[model samples]
Target: MIARQYLERAGLHFYAANVTLRGGELDLIMRDGETWVFVEVRYRRTSLYGDAAASVSYTKQRRLLHSAAIWLTERGGSFDTTDCRFDVLAITGSQLQWLPNAFAAAE
Candidate 1:
């Protein structure tokens, strides 16, 4: 619910992707015109280990990329690197942080 609102406010049209695969589950898959934005929505009431965006470790990025591949292949769309980016919608308490192109798969 919060994730949807954040995306909507950002002026990006999106949909929740339910890719119940083996490893990971992406929170929301968004569309920004020709760009395919894979959003990872995270919330933490208290910052114990790190911020919500920092919680998305390297392993999680791999999982997101893997799920995205599965989604694209299943949808049968031509693969291209146009404006693809990984976004993180971090929520801590009532504060919201939007990190665009947070990290890459190699990270």
Candidate 2:
């Protein structure tokens, strides 16, 4: 809810779809201008293991990327441009950090 609230407050209308069947989950999906964004919502009070953003490992990124590809292929016409990104919204306590282009090409 906080994430949606933040995105709404930021003036970005979004779609939140649960894609657990594919084993790749997207907390929220939104259109940022002409760009399609697959967002992973994270919450970590402290960085005991690591910051929430930092926790998106290569494996996780690959899964998210795969799921995104599936979504694009299934939706058809939803993605016109090659401009897509994996974003991370890290809410550590009361602070909200948005990481754009959170990862490079999926490995």
Candidate 3:
């Protein structure tokens, strides 16, 4: 809900939510102009270990990239011509932070 509201407030069009591919899942997908924004939502009650954003480790990033590629393939779009970005929405307590292009799509 937080992530969707944030994207809506930013004027981005919502595409899909909780999209599950074979490898992984995308929390939210939105269209930011011509770019497809694949978002990962994370929530942490307390930051004792680390913040919510910090939990999206290297492995998680790779899985997201793979899933995104699968989505494009299934959607029958040319990846070379399409623009895509990975975003992260971190919710800690009452604070919500949207990190655009939080991680690269490379391993």
Best by TM-score: 3
Range of the 10 consecutive residues with the lowest summed lDDT in candidate 3: 73-82
TM-score of every candidate: 0.85, 0.83, 0.94
Candidate 1 structure lDDT: 0.78
Pairs that collide in candidate 3 are none
Candidate 3 off by > 4 Å: none
RMSD of 1: 2.0
Report the C-alpha lDDT of model 3 over 75-104, residue by residue, as the tens digit: 886457579889999988777888999986
Candidate 2 local Cα displacement, residue 80, angstroms: 7.9
Overall lDDT per candidate, in order of appearance? 0.78, 0.76, 0.88
Would you give me the overall lDDT of model 2? 0.76
Ranked candidates (lDDT, high to low): 3, 1, 2
Ranking by TM-score: 3, 1, 2
Q: Tens digit of lDDT per residue, candidate 2, span 38-107?
A: 8888889987877787777778888887788777777774334457777788987777898877875434
Query: 1-107 in candidate 1: lDDT tens per residue?
Result: 87777788889897765546657787888888878888888899978878788898888888888877677767775236345678999998788999988876445
Best candidate, lDDT? 3
Root-mean-square deviation per candidate:
2.0, 2.3, 1.2
Flag regions of model 2 displaced more than 4 Å: 77-82, 105-107
